[model samples]
Target: MSHGVKKRKLDKNAQESLYFDSYSDVTIHEEMIADRVRTSTYRAAILRNAEAIRGRVVLDVGAGTGVLSVFCAQAGAGRVYAVEACSIAEQAVKIVKQNQMEDRIEVIRGTVETIDLPESVDVIVSEWMGYALLHESMLGSVLFARDKWLKPGGLILPCRAELYVAPVSDPVVEERLNFWCTVRDQYGVDMSCMSDFAKRCILSGDIAVTPVTVEDVLSHPARIAELDLRSVTAEQLRSVRGEFACECFGSSAVNALCVWFTVTFPCEDNKTLVLSTSPFKPETHWKQAVLYLDEPTDVMQDTKVAGEIHMYPSEDSARHICIHVDYTIGEHKKHSKTFSIPDGYSEAQQ
Candidate 1:
């Protein structure tokens, strides 16, 4: 139930540098590589599509540690251009050599948009998904590589993606909101007055990234947006807007909207491989994005919450994501709110 707010806006260059610098830390990469659901799904997708990769030149965009590039090489890719803009590329260079894949892999330490390859690639692979599918804005780089280097009819490792949303009853929010009352009883200090201030601080800005369980969900999930990586354009990604209407399973108070995503890989024999970050499925590094409501709304069985959700890059930092939600619960008046996914940079001085 913790939240963060950006105290000051950063210039584009500073923001870009901060984003890459964070990736240089080994901890972040360790989390990603250790996410079994995330790593194994990608491995299955690459191996399942081995025929498409064999004898083909491939490009791995934002290739942190070059794991995916190695997978492609093992799948018999003729050559792999592993493009990484962060210092992690140095580790990727060592990893490729240690795997005895130096001949098939070329680690390029530059942004995909600025890097030049000797020839077009028959396949483009990348694990560019961020929280809730678009938070980090890495899809833009993948699209750039796709347009600049992918051969005609070339395949995207995860060819399609979908974002989903549903109303949820989060007991943790209520517990946090009520903690101030406990302080008064414990220490004879009337800190209960801070409840309003605490709520204000939480709902003020920044979306919470937490693990949501199926029991917490109050309604069936609805698909809000689907992106076909092969054809979706950068302009289209600038703002992804979709409308959703979900019915509550029973009586409960809705505290927030739970969001997650899934990506698919098209394989041979008409089979499709899916990697989901849904709470109903095994958890991944991307647990879920929860947008807390200013006030909880109680609903009865079959109550409907209808709304439109809009996701876009923050104007201050293109790498950050902003979400706008306009929704009406049952027959109540419409409620509108916007939340931002924090850039995770250092807090600005007060």
Candidate 2:
């Protein structure tokens, strides 16, 4: 091989290594296991679709700790292949054995794309969501598995996913911006001038992973994107774009746009099980992703905030996400800004 090709390969490997290595930590697994809202929903969804899983081969992509694989075995799946690329897969092997399900569930340590399955899967189950739904781009792996190993008429748990965005009045941003003013009162320094710099620092195109309250919401959320896992393509995953228009509930300052997602599992008789990570819903480890506007927009009741949002992978690394917003509040001039997950922050940990 050539020197340039080797450098490119190393760069790609380094980026992927950083992502997989984070999952090796125990704290991340503890957080996901402790997220009742996430775990219970998957368990219920699997059991609810027992007919589809029972006596069928199953594949669990990005199977961290093999929890979902065990769930499949409980659902009477004939065989379950749990594919994980991180060091955590070793622990998953022990976990499966401890549960005395070693025979039914086989934990394989490798990316779904590279691993070879003995047979096609009848059902694919995975907890592939990230902050704002697409932050870590793990769905790409699910899609790869689905296309390569899923049998015809096979099922994908949480087959549908929807992304939502709402205008929010974040007091946290207000508090942070106001803190500069208080520096003179408490520390006897005229540091209020730093407020502008702080505003720029906070809103300078980096998405914030933080908790948002129901009361902080200024308007009803609009669905920005929907992914039908069965039909969604890898090319489509490159850029998920949608337009939204939300009317303000009451006069308030819209400091940021909060994004969340919900996935649905199809059950018997058209029933569906939904797992939501919304501020309006119970809190989860994957908190709301907030994009603070550089300049907060003031609005009256019923004012419309119309805009387009484009979410895609960053050029430097496919796992990293970039979000671009182009919006106009009421009759104000059009405004545009872009945001991204900060470097070194692993959305996979969420």
Question: Tens digit of lDDT per residue, candidate 2, span 1-350?
Answer: 23365333237788889889888899889999999999999999999888888999999999999999999999999999999999999999999999999989999999998889878999999999988898875899999999999999899998999999999998878899999999988989989999988987877788998999999898899999999999999999999999999999998899899999999999986889899999999999899999999788899999999999999888877877899999999999999999988766764444
Cα displacement (angstroms), candidate 2, residue 55, comes to: 1.0
lDDT of 1 at 216: 92
lDDT of 1 by residue, 1-350 (tens): 44385467888889888888878888888888999999999998998889999999999999999999999999999999999999999999999999999999999999987878999999999999988788875899999999999989998989999999999999988998999989978999999899999899776657888899999998889999999999999999999999999999999999899989999999986989999999999989889999998889999999999899999988888878899999999999999999987545222200
Q: Give the TM-score of candidate 1.
A: 0.95
State residue 63's C-alpha deviation in candidate 1, in Å.
Answer: 0.5
RMSD values, in order shown? 3.0, 4.1
**Model 2 spans with C-alpha error above 4 angstroms:** 1-10, 347-350
Lowest summed lDDT over 10 consecutive residues: which window, candidate 1?
341-350
**Whole-model lDDT for model 2 versus the true structure?**
0.91
